[model samples]
Structure formats: C-alpha cells, structure tokens
Target: MILGKCPYCDDGMIEVREKEVSGKKVKLYACSNAHWTTEDGEMFELRADASCDFRVWQNSLARYGKWLSYKDMKDLLNDESIEVELISKKFGKKTYYNKHISLNPEYGVSVIWD
Candidate 1:
C-alpha cells in the first residue's frame, strides 16, 4: 500500500513493504526512490547508492500497541488533538493511561506522557 509522500524527498513516495525481521514478518514504510542502485530490482533493498533515506516502521505509528489509521496519522500531522489510551505493563501487571499523540520528524509518532 502507498502511505503518502516521502517527508524527506521532494519526488519520492512512501510505499509499504513486508519484510522478515528476527524470524517475524513486519511491515515497513519506505521511500520508493530511496537508497538503492538503479540495477536493483527490489526497492526494499538498502544500498549506499546515494538516494533518499526515508523509511519508517509500520508500528512506529502505534500508540500503546494500537496501530493508528492513515486518517489518524494525517490528523496528527495537521496538529489535531488526539487522546490515546496507552497500555503499560509492569511487573506482570497491566495498566492503562491517556496521552496526547503527535508526529515527530525523527520518529514516526510520539506521545506526550507529561
């Protein structure tokens, strides 16, 4: 699935790819024209060929283990107020708390705990 445009590159689009990490499959959002050789057929392959280096994990948009939708991400990017319930586990106990979520340039998303 195409998520959106790359925030770092002017003409690059963000595309979703499924990859295996540590024996588990996960989704990663990467720039369509990111760091890779023109000879490489796979866009997901990372190479130091001097291209846009913009990629983000799908779970990076998750708040408290809940994945946010594209609309939610767009809303957050627009500075819309959003309250998320964060699930916290400590010492084998589970608890929930509320937090405000926002988009971070370095990170895909961030939650305010304070």
Candidate 2:
C-alpha cells in the first residue's frame, strides 16, 4: 500500500483507493480519518510516464511560440484560461528560468501554474 505521513491529524497514512488515468495506475491514500487525500497536487507529484521535471519544465518554456511580451503574459494566463504570475521564493524568477530554459534565456518568462 502507499505510505505517507499526516501532519494535521493522523501520523500514519495508508492507501484508501486506487484508480486509472490515461492508462496509468493512480493510488489514493488517506490519513486515517480521510481528511486529506493523495491526489494530483498532494502526493501524486511524480509521473513515471514523463521523462523528467526538467524536460517538462523545458517544454512549458518552449510552448511560447515566440518570446512573450510582459503584457502578453497577462492575456495568455487570464482568469478564464489560466492564472499566471511571477514568484520568488527560494530563487528568483530569473534564476529558475535560467535553469529551465538555458538554451533561450532571453525567451524565459515566469508563468505561475494555477
């Protein structure tokens, strides 16, 4: 069974359910009382199907047909479509972009995933 920890209520987490998505095995786990679940954003952070995070990040970077202007970002990630923003937590946008799109640093732009 899937294993995890619950910082909110229960200490030990266990698998509660399983499902298939796009022909991939997906297991859902819980923290005893089933308050929180292991799904898209919580526990299922890895996609064994994908090559790697770097490749995924690079693809996202390349999706921009051409270098997007500052204002273009606002429209591209609108409320109706998607929400995007620049954030600086551990490293600034400039740093992260450098590592992601090293080939085209000038084309790098931060678009928050929401």
Predicted model with the maximum TM-score = 1
Q: Identify the leading candidate in terms of lDDT.
A: 1
lDDT of 2 at 93: 34
Taking the tens digit of each residue's C-alpha lDDT, what string does model 2 give over 1-114?
433333333344433344454465444333344432236543434344432221111123333333333333333323223233333345433322222222112222344332
Off by over 4 Å in 2: 21-24, 35-114
Q: Estimate, for each residue in 40-82, the C-alpha lDDT of model 1 and write its tens digit.
A: 3334455776467676665664545666665554455345457
TM-score of each: 0.64, 0.23
Candidate 1: give its CA RMSD in angstroms: 4.9
Cα lDDT over the full model 2: 0.33
